[model samples]
Target: MNKEFDDNGAAEFEKLLQGVKPLAQDKLHFRPPVKSRKQIIENSHRQTAEVVFSDIYQPLLPSEGPMRWNREDVDPVEVKRLRRGDYVPEYLLDLHGMRQTEAKREISALIQACVRQNSPCCCIMHGHGTGILKQQLPIWLAQHPDVKAFHKANKEWGGDAALLVLVDVAEPTQKR
Candidate 1:
């Protein structure tokens, strides 16, 4: 069924849904909240001494909890690949000397080329400056519909100066 709503009708519908007449108000059953300050210390001198001791000499403790991060799961092959920059790239565009507008255009063109050429990955160097390029580039990159994922390069690569980008692989015939 086709449904269409006009401006006035939409407004009235919103008002009705919101119960703007105030006659349908429900009674809230929230209870009074409890408030109390904790009495942590009895004497100022004793408290100060305890605080100083705790700050200086935190004794070794037993490891009862498991680690939240996994180091062994890290792939050595992938790390080496990134370090050597061996990933087959579709295009490499340098933004080192280009202005902001020109850089954006170049990035867009490279992205289009990558998509058209069925490139799996690409690299972009934004440098570690005042974040003018770093900031603007990511915003545009994120907004790109063709971009699958993009991340900061590892230390072996350009590090934060470059990005590892994943692009949609186009059909074979579209390669340039």
Candidate 2:
């Protein structure tokens, strides 16, 4: 064996690689860096505007008329069924004699509880008095994201004085 070659193998290897050029930078393509899962979730949450209730009350059309609201994707037939009181409410919140502020709080809490319990329907009796509650209830219900649909209760219930609210219950998230 050659003494020089055996002793300087690393030097000889470096000499062989001296003239070799690396691949062009433009030809070495790479995908853009992906966002972390937490970052994506935070971004999504940030993009959604917070729901605010202000100046929601206005003079409703008729004092005797039934009030109704439904999401655009909800079926009209289902709304008709709700109007007819086909589905019995699992819970009820009577806001009959309560003031506007108290009634609003009760309504919010009741709806949230019902949603958490996965209750499909609920009733809110605002009564047919001076029509203050009746006028404001629809606006408040419209603002609630979980309220899928709501209509004046049927005659068997409180009729125009009460509302049959259909709540959308989100499925419980499964853990990985």
Candidate 3:
């Protein structure tokens, strides 16, 4: 059978692609999805597959003391590594003048972004201006499940005014 140009088929193809556009490079995922489409939900307060941060119960944290926390399963050495400035922060968030509510949301977004980008380590500079955000940062971070560990930054990364956090993400599988 010899092929011939079918005008109707060509018109249908054009119609299908008339409004289609390429996905943004930044939005593209290079790795396979961790969860099925049904399990993933995207919203202002929800980004990660099944993680949410709550601000209701504030934990006991020293107002001016060095901030540090880690999940029970996480090793203490991880916090030591953060204090040593071993893992350079892949993302930095400066919450200078925002209120507690706004600061919380920004932190949530920061963690979500870090996980999506496969950046296990990041920094949050809450500043020592009013000491409001500074005091609240660790409380909020401790509530998130993805926050594996965090410690007060060393002098190089801002010292007493910032925190270095380690987010939980799957390690890249090596190809044999």
lDDT of 2 by residue, 99-149 (tens): 876676677777767877888799999998999887778877877777888
Query: What's model 2's lDDT at 13?
Result: 83
* Per-residue lDDT over 1-176 for candidate 3, one digit per residue giving the tens place of the 0 to 100 score: 12345777787899999989987767766897588564554354544312454556676554565788888899989988888878999899999888776677678888878878889999999888978787678878888888999999988788889999999976676312
- How are the candidates ranked when ordered by TM-score, highest leading? 3, 2, 1
State in Å the error of residue 28, model 3. Answer: 36
Tens digit of lDDT per residue, candidate 1, span 83-136? Answer: 456664556666786666567556766776686666867888878778777656
The best candidate in terms of lDDT:
3
Per-model C-alpha lDDT, please? 0.58, 0.76, 0.80
lDDT of predicted model 1: 0.58
**Could you list the CA RMSD of all candidates, in the order they appear?**
23.9, 13.3, 13.8
Q: Where does candidate 1 stray beyond 4 Å?
A: 1-88, 171-176
What is the C-alpha local distance difference test score of candidate 2? 0.76
Better of 2 and 3 by lDDT: 3
Judged by TM-score, which candidate is best?
3
